[model samples]
Target: MPRVGLFIPCYIDQFYPDVGLATLEVLEQHGCEVDYPAAQTCCGQPMANTGCTDAAVPLAERMINVFAPYDYVVAPSGSCVAMVREHYTDLLPLTNKLQEFQAKTFELCEFLTDVLKVDSISGSFPYKVGVHQSCHGLRELRLARSSETVGDDFDKARQLLKSLDGISFAELTRTDECCGFGGTFAVHEEAVSCMMGRDRLADHRAAGTEVLTAGDMSCLMHLNGLNQRHAQPFPVMHIAQILAGRQPEGITPVNSTDGSVA
Candidate 1:
């Protein structure tokens, strides 16, 4: 078992802490000796993405040092993991340790599939789950094959999710479309972001999706917001929560819907 340091992204920490906890649960189930670094904070993806690399430098450095002692640093977010892997070189003077840290930082599904060699998951989530392949995960982490690429297609997240008994996958019209939550892109272009998000929501709803799940909570966060704004929210959960034996049926508002027309 690898000694893993959990990297909970800022959004997950403040807004969706349960996702962070669920990620911890999933990691532990697979025999990871998990430790959450209380010192761990934002990895500065927002700042870096917005061309403020200088502002992101200190935060990126903090993450590197905080998780340096662990054998592996695992995060539930592919976008955040992509930040450490793809963007950190611009933010810091690269040391050998920084290089190694970049290589070893695995998204939760990647850790389960690539690191732990997890093919068969032990759980049951019998619902039509609509898969959202966020940009960072699809392109950066290569968690799933991008639609534009030429190759035998693959989806690491779907592979893990399907391993659960009785899980039915919703056939999305556009499988790998962006959910309009490009970190700072959403903040800068709110109207466009919400429009794109609603499009995603409509696709999922049309597919008769029982629950929507994705490897990256940020994508789900954007879609979930649209679901709410339309006054017909379904249960939107992280893939970690589903894999860890949690169900959307257990939600307080019964899928966060208010008995209104969508």
Candidate 2:
């Protein structure tokens, strides 16, 4: 069992702690020695995404120091992991330690599949699922083949979910479409973001998705806001939650009446 340092993103840490807990559950269940460093905080994705590399540097350095002792650093979020693996180049200079950190840090599914070599998970979800391919997960991490590229159909999320006892997937018209939650992108582009999110949800609804799941909760968070606000509501859960044997009961939905759900 590899000693895993669990890196929960800021949104998952603050808004959707359940997702973080589910990630820890799944890792440990699969024979990983997972530890949540209380000192852990945001991976500086927000600042860096907004062209504030200087502001993100301290957080990045701190993160490297905090998780250095562990054999591997894993996170439930692809975007956050992508920030460490890709964007750290801008925030910090190239060094042996930085390179080592980037190489070992992985998103939850990648860690399970690549490190653990787990092709199948002993879990089950009976509902039809629609997977929202997160931008960072698809593009940066290459967790799945993008629609823009012509290649064999391979999806890490689907691979694990397909192994479940009774679960089906919706063959979305656009499988690798972005959920319009690019961290600060959703805030700055609210109207476009809302429309894009609604379109993704509608695509899933048309394809008969009973439950919506994704590797990144930030994507699910944006979609769930629209999920609860819109007419056709469905349960939204993190992939880790399903992989950990937890059933979705609208875990990500907000009341949709106000901004009360923070």
Candidate 3:
């Protein structure tokens, strides 16, 4: 078993701890010796994305220090993993330590497929699910071939989900479109952000999916907020939760007037 360090994103640790717990359970089920550095915090994605590299530096350094000792570092959110793998080179001074840390960091799906060589999960979900291809996961990590790309194609996320016993994928019109939750982009451009999120939800609704699942919770949160405000009938879930056979609780159904799980 490999020595793995779990990197739970700041928002995931706070707002959606279930996702983090599910991630831990999945990794452990696969025979990994997992460790969580309790001192871990944000990966500085928000600060860096908002053009504040100085503020992001300390966070980046802290991540390197905490995760450096492990053989592999994995995170449930592709956006956060992408920050370390792609942006850390630019954020921190080029050092062998930083390079090693970046090289070992991987998104959860990528780690399961590439590192663990897992073909299937014991989890099952009978509902039709719409997969939101997060920009960082799809574009940065190459978890899936972009619709814009031409040639042989494969999707790590879809491949893993296909292994589940009763899972069915919802047919999305724009499968690779961004969900409009680009960290601080949603806050700085509220109208555009909400419009984009609603448009993404519209695509999912058109597919008649009972649930929406994605690798990034930030995107799901933005999309779910729009879905709730408009009384849409689906819940947004993290792929980790689905793959671990755990459904999120307290999420209101789309048609419910009040935000209460049905």
Candidate 4:
């Protein structure tokens, strides 16, 4: 078993603790010796996204310091992992630590599909969901590549969801595109971001998708907020929670559920 360090991003840790929990459960179930370094943080995504490399250095240093010895640094968020894998090296030029850490870090889906070779998961959910590809996860990470058709083309989210007993999913028209929730880009370019989100929502509504799922809450929050604002009936969810066999609509982890629960 490999020693794994789970790096939950600041936003996910603060607002969506359940995503972290689900990631923990899934990793543990899959035989990884996972440990959470509480001091771990933002992965400097906000600063890096804002082009503030100077401000991000300390956070990058802190993260590298905490998880330096781990065999692998894993996170459920692609953007953050991409920051570590792709941008941190460029941003934190003074430190060899960022480069080393980036090499070791793996986005949850990438680890599952590439390292874990996971054909399926032990958990499941029963719902009609449309997957929203966080731009970084799908493109920056090359997560859903059709070129590498060696295995099931099993995206981590799709693979995990398929493990459920009665879950049925609806595929969206555009599988991998931006959800218009580009971190602070939404705030800076509000009109364009909203328009992009509206386009995404239109596809979800067309699919009659009950829950829109994605790896990043940033995207989900954007889509969900728009859903709420426009009085759209559908909801959004993180793939981690769905894979951990947790249900929405007031379903907590304490509930013991089995059978084809559609």
TM-scores for all candidates: the values are 0.93, 0.93, 0.93, 0.87
TM-score of 1: 0.93
Per-residue lDDT of model 1, residues 191-214, tens digit only: 999989988989999998878999
The candidate that wins on TM-score is 2
Which candidate do you rate higher for TM-score, 1 or 4? 1
Question: Against the true structure, whose lDDT is highest?
Answer: 2
lDDT over C-alpha atoms for residue 181 of model 3: 84
Q: Any runs in candidate 3 off by more than 4 Å, and if so which? A: 248-262
lDDT of each: 0.87, 0.88, 0.87, 0.78
Q: What would the per-residue lDDT of candidate 2 be over residues 1-262, giving only the tens digit for each residue?
A: 7999999898888898888888999899889998989898788999988998888999999999999989999999999999999889988999999999999999999988888989998955777789889999999999999988988988888889999866778889888777887788899999999999989998999998889999999999999999998766889999998998888775342222352432
Candidate 1 Cα errors over 4 Å, as ranges: 250-262
By lDDT, the better pick of 2 and 4 is: 2
RMSD in Å for all candidates? 4.4, 6.4, 4.7, 4.2
